[model samples]
Target chain A: MSPQDNQSTSVAASTTPTASESASARKVSRTEVRGRVWKQLPLLLGLVVLWGVLWGQFSWLNILTGFLVAIAVTRVLYLPPADISGRLNLWYSLVFIAHFIADVTVASFTVAFQALNPRPIPTSSVIAVQLRTRSDFVMTLDAIAMSLVPGSIVVEVDRERAILYFHTFDTTTAAAVEAMRAKVLVVEARIVRAIGSKDDLARIYETEATR
Target chain B: MILDSILDILTGVFLLLGGFLSVAAGVGLIRFPDAIARLHATTKPQILGLAFILLAIALQERQVSTILLLIFLLIFQMITAPVSAHMIARAGYRGGIIAPRSLLVDELEQAIDAAPEFDDTERASE
Candidate 1:
């Protein structure tokens, strides 16, 4: 674990920072810059709301102070802001949430039962799935959601290619592996439908049409 | 009066379910064959178990702030859990700690094998 972790960090340290630096270095028009900052507004507001929630109060004074604090933190502890797709389909979001909850519940029990079963230990696999959307945000959300649902854990991410390699547990057959890969695509599609950019939506639809 | 008992019963059921899942998680850690398998064992059931427990807490307290805090905690857990799991799995895979015999297929290994190695000069630039 130690050697591998060191290698992982070395690889991560080498590859990731350069990409981020290049992104920040890229030239953008004034409106694009403004839009980027505008995209951060929700995050700032969410921070303010989180502060109020933490204090268990929403007083005007609290809100004002929270706003100031949010400003301070965002500046002092800077992180790249997410470019959220402004289009959020409420119906699809609800459906995604519903399906996610169901997956978590069902998968948890299945793993539990498998763990306690007397049968021979099932074999697992590491499979990579190419994502339709190149959006980092959607990829991350999909990874997080997939990880929590059980049976799959994200092992490595190829950011440039929009590929996620997942370690799938207790899948013994090629068919099962294929099934899991298909399931990952379905999950990604649901996420894209909910809040993906127009480009992402078109990419997903194009693939679906071709399929 | 009846509603109170029903809520109490619901709380008990959720708590019991959470406890069962936690126990299963513990059993899985010991029972699974390899590192990745153990990772799945611990992550999946523990999250659902924690969710159940949080649900029980929300049911019992029935306060706006408490529920809010509970949601925050769960969200924090959900966000962090996968990150740590990914880190561990990535390291373990790189470390060669996971036994190759245990896996039915290892697509990542093939990809890793096929990719060209980075030279020291390239790494030194960063």
Candidate 2:
């Protein structure tokens, strides 16, 4: 048999391994030693650059102390793991950067407009919006983006019902609220597609009505 | 004198951008639609913007230890911000502070119940 056939045969045979061996194999595949190194490279590079800059003034002992302190802080704070898959997509970061710039610019203008206007900006109201994206990360990003837009804030999120309550400085009608909601959803969809798994995205938008 | 002037200008620009981002995050915290969203506004920019400011300070001071401490602060903020946000959101959910129409799935409630019950109320109070 060819090497491929032989490998397949070995894999098939290994599948029926006794419990202990199976557990070991399971760990091997899931741990994926190569993937971890690749995934951690960016963070490690950042650390190295930071260390190099510090090494000029600090003794070895001080450097060690600094590292220990950083690690302790990291442990206490418990930063969530970056989406490994998302980081691989170069376009994801670009899109997020673009979105952030646009959001900040528009928000600045809106805030300025409100400040310049003497009146209470007509009316303010809270509107209920249904979210299409489900991933916590995507949802969080969406909310951050919307809230940064000067006149709106996310007051509540109902994960069970997939709804959000947004307070707006100028909610005139249902249609206007809906238009804003649609804009938020569109931005979220772009972000989700750029940075999340297709399966996660689908599950996020999944509803009896939308499905 | 020219070098000093350039350094001063660079420092000023970094500080300005950092302050702008921080303000944006504050606005977002007050304006977003829900607890989950507000968490993003409160956390992400706080880390990123603060990191930039710290970096600018380090550059201005040009001290190794100061730079290291600032880096430590950045890492700490990055790690803690999300956890704090998560805790606040969970509390908001339990308290019925969240709206009913925005969520489509909730895996957290099950996880929260199944996990060991510490006095969450006391935790929140603290």
Candidate 3:
């Protein structure tokens, strides 16, 4: 084994047990606690808005109740601090939404046509797509987007290689499989551009363009 | 008057198409051979059907509050549906309920064999 590898392993072995034990009972400095709450502010606001919508009233009374409910829920639920890069490109977000809407419409028609067709169902495949993005947010977004479209659903996610195993309908050829893989990468690029850090956005697009 | 009639007709079309797609999804669920195909039936059309229904509702009730609620319903459904499907697919895969013949690629099986975390779960199923 390499010297660096041995050193890292030793460090891991030494810290793991104590680190895990402290994870649950760890005390935060006041400044760190305040920082966490500040980071969660957007989430709290979003919950309040959701509460108002659920009640079908955006009136002052509803807003007040929603705020109280949101605070109560946040306090009870131990939510980790959000890792928001806070780099949002409005243009990219709009484009992504437009693309998503188009995909949804296309998917609806495709599935509907397949369901209503007189011919026998073609064989489907469980295809492995190796994704480029390793970020948890990107992977989750891709999974949700692909799964919601109907012709495919993510059966397994191998986080190590960032591969998604999809149960896909009517993928008969290697070319088709590659096309699906490309489409996912394209979607990831769009997502990274929309909300990811500027460096992430540039790197994804740059790498995708090269491919 | 003409505009109102046109809106009504559009609403009717949306609702009709939505209902048709939903029925098609139901048929797919029954006719599809295995677990994965059945999941495709459950998720795809249902969200669009719900969207169409919400559109119809929004058209009928032009109140801002009602529209907001409908929009929220759509957003929540879009978020929750895929998550539930993922969970079910994972369970079905781990439990070995999904047929081998039905699967074309078995990368996940290979992944589990390589990964240590799934060892206990995979063995327990056996």
Candidate 4:
């Protein structure tokens, strides 16, 4: 769903969009609904895997029951079908994962050191990064990755505009804020390359061309 | 025998690092000025610390079931921590617990003001 084009405008408005109800209330276009199971394959598989993991068993009995329970849960609770790009890039995915871990490691040390230092932090900033993709999955993953990278907390997301507002530490200057914004965009770019849809890739190109 | 000793030492190092990072988060929580800043302290190091400890656990046990559970735990933490962090930050900002003056830049406030739907940050400012 294009956050900017979302019909949730009539609902309560804030820097962040109100959480859509049960996720069921959100609109799903016909194009997004390729086929029932085809669209939901990932969700069902995730649930099954989650079930098996919870049980800590990979036995055949566990698989059968997990699949059954997954079907039941999906049937019982309506969730918005995630918009998947249907493309998987293993190399890019590995790159994202590796870099993400390294980021967490390095940034954690930096922030931890700052915390332990006697000197007080002067200021922080709330900066917005307009993401290239409006895909919910990509946006969610991007937000998660950025938040995990330390020094930044996702304060608000303007779902309608595909904008993410981050409250970050040590960004007292406009240039520092700009750097933070660029950092978030790079994270978004990494996500888009990993599993982003065709439209998302195209939008990234458009952004590059425009810049 | 030598590899076993090295692995044991590595596990010990991971555990020590994990503990140190967690302590750092605690120190950060006490030191940071406000809720948003404290959030960075609480979440950032805490997650990586947990990851380190979990890795230590996996290394020590080297059991399939143990490792799988750890993996699930890590995945869930990665997914959920950001969400809760976001919610806390959002509440702090909207409730105006996060002092407006402490912030060097607030692009969100302008956007909130620009929206046609709602009225007033007077309650927020107060």
Candidate 5:
């Protein structure tokens, strides 16, 4: 089935609405169907590459099989249709990747050092930060990035208020809480620049200016 | 032959560091005072350590097929580690496993105070 058809089906399945009702609500053309599939091509390719790696083979036959398996699994899994902004700032993405690598390296060392230290363990805190972007894509990315960074992990997301709750290490004071909050916003801003739509980026800048 | 030996040595070093980090994460899990702090031990170094081990395996193995598997392992670990941690932390919070003294700011609690559905639980906690 075309990706547009897949999207309609997934959307219908996601909400309480009936399949026929959703199908009739929106008319999707053949070109639009192709476009939607093209949009999901990255996810497909990533899955196929992952499958190939998992099989530990890079041969054309293995890759072809992986590609086919990727398609089948994704189709059967019933994932929500990807909602990527489609706009990418190459420079910002490169910077973001570099920053992420550095953060991971540094944060891991810091956490490891503290964990192994004989001194009293610094108190941890659960802090809430309001996010500017409302996109689930950005929010998920932000949470994933933060969680992997060693010092903090996302505990909850209040989707309606665009507020994210994080459990952070060594956040004993109000200043420390604010610092962690600022750090999260900085990371969010980088993600916004790297992949968010123009409106999202503009909102980030506006939020930053106001703060 | 010399270059191959050098690659093997580097891979071994990476594998050692990965093992050490994994051990450190275990230590943190035991040493941490609360559920959330323990989650840091379970998530961060564990995933990074696995990545290192996967990288070492990928480097030493010449088979394209096996390398693909190693890469997949690394990616999947990275993706799932955070998600699993998130689930556990949320469950811990909702279950009241969070040490009230450790929480610096309780915005969720404040929100729950205003929420009618949470009124009884909020009062009970107080």
Candidate 6:
């Protein structure tokens, strides 16, 4: 008998009560694997290059250790199933990085200036920030980035209301709070466009602008 | 005297930059209107700032173990920062935080709609 037929027959024998042959015929296909691999090639290539660079200095034993470490890292940092969005363009990602770099530099100077000043830092307050992006990943990345900066922390989130309570060291007035919110929203919108579904972005624009 | 002065100056420079970045991130967190924007400000500077501080320490002490530990700490922070950010963002979404103006779409709404409803009683308790 042919290998294909033999394998099919074994698969059939494993399940008897139901019509296993027909089910097997429909279940797995070679074409599906090829399509998945085709879609994932870029991601795979990136991973391989990254791994090689990170492990380049290691000996064979050290390579093995690194491999284990990589695996552990993956397990610990396993992200939620990404909502694959057709709209995520490479250009958007580049722009997001560029904008982020600018923000970082600006913020660094702002904080340093504050530190140099002798006046007592103003009393802090939690400002409620409303978001527009619908993608969980983009929003989360933004929040994390905000929390890492100086003089502020994300204290609480009212997800239902789509509002974030941000603790600030210098909460002077409602206008100041609003200005901060606007800046964050603009960046979040850019990030969402970079990494989120086009449909998601549309909804956000529609809801936020109209409201 | 000159060499020692140079080393002291270098250390001071690193400390200043690191401290500035850390404070900037904190201020951005408080100042930025939304979580995502705040996160953008926070992650990059915090990593850069901490790296600077650690480098200064390594230079000052010039010890092998301290350097190794510093390297380990930097790696740990780099990995954890993004992962934690991802998690909190996801949780924020499941919890229902809306994006601000400028976003153009809403794929999450579809997912939330498609998701099967649990007992209303459970939701109310939350």
Best by TM-score: 1
Ranking by lDDT: 1, 4, 5, 3, 6, 2
Residues A137-158, candidate 4: write the lDDT tens digits.
Answer: 7888888899999989888776
What TM-score would candidate 1 get against the native? Answer: 0.90
Measured on C-alpha atoms, candidate 3 has an lDDT of: 0.74
Please identify which of the two predictions, 3 or 6, would achieve the higher lDDT against the true structure: 3
- TM-scores (chain A) of the candidates: 0.86, 0.61, 0.80, 0.81, 0.83, 0.64
Against the reference, the lDDT scores of all candidates come to 0.86, 0.56, 0.74, 0.82, 0.79, 0.57
CA lDDT for candidate 4: 0.82
Off by over 4 Å in 6: A1-47, A57-80, A158-161, A207-211, B1-46, B51-126
Q: What is the TM-score of chain B alone in each candidate?
A: 0.91, 0.72, 0.88, 0.90, 0.84, 0.75
The sequence of per-residue lDDT tens digits that candidate 3 reaches over residues A1-211 is 3322221211111122333434853687889778777877888898988888777668999889988999999777655454566677999899988999889888887877777787777566667777666565677787788888767787766655678787777666767766777777788888888887666677787786886
- Alpha-carbon TM-score of each model against the true structure: 0.90, 0.49, 0.85, 0.87, 0.85, 0.52
DockQ for all models: 0.59, 0.12, 0.42, 0.58, 0.46, 0.11
By DockQ thresholds, what CAPRI class is model 5? acceptable
TM-score of chain B of 1: 0.91
- The residue pairs found clashing in candidate 1 are A4-B95
Interface RMSD (one decimal) of model 5: 7.3
- Candidates 1 and 6 compared by DockQ, better number: 1
* Interface RMSD, per-candidate values to 1 decimal: 4.0, 13.9, 7.5, 5.4, 7.3, 14.0
Per-residue lDDT tens digits for candidate 2, residues A126-206, read 556677654655666666566555455555455444565555545456666667667677667667767766775675567
Deviation from native of the Cα of residue A179 in model 5, angstroms? 1.0
- Give the runs in model 2 whose Cα sits over 4 Å from its true position: A1-84, A160-162, A200-211, B1-126
- Choose 3 or 4, whichever is better by lDDT: 4
Instruction: Give lDDT: candidate 2, residue A159.
Output: 46
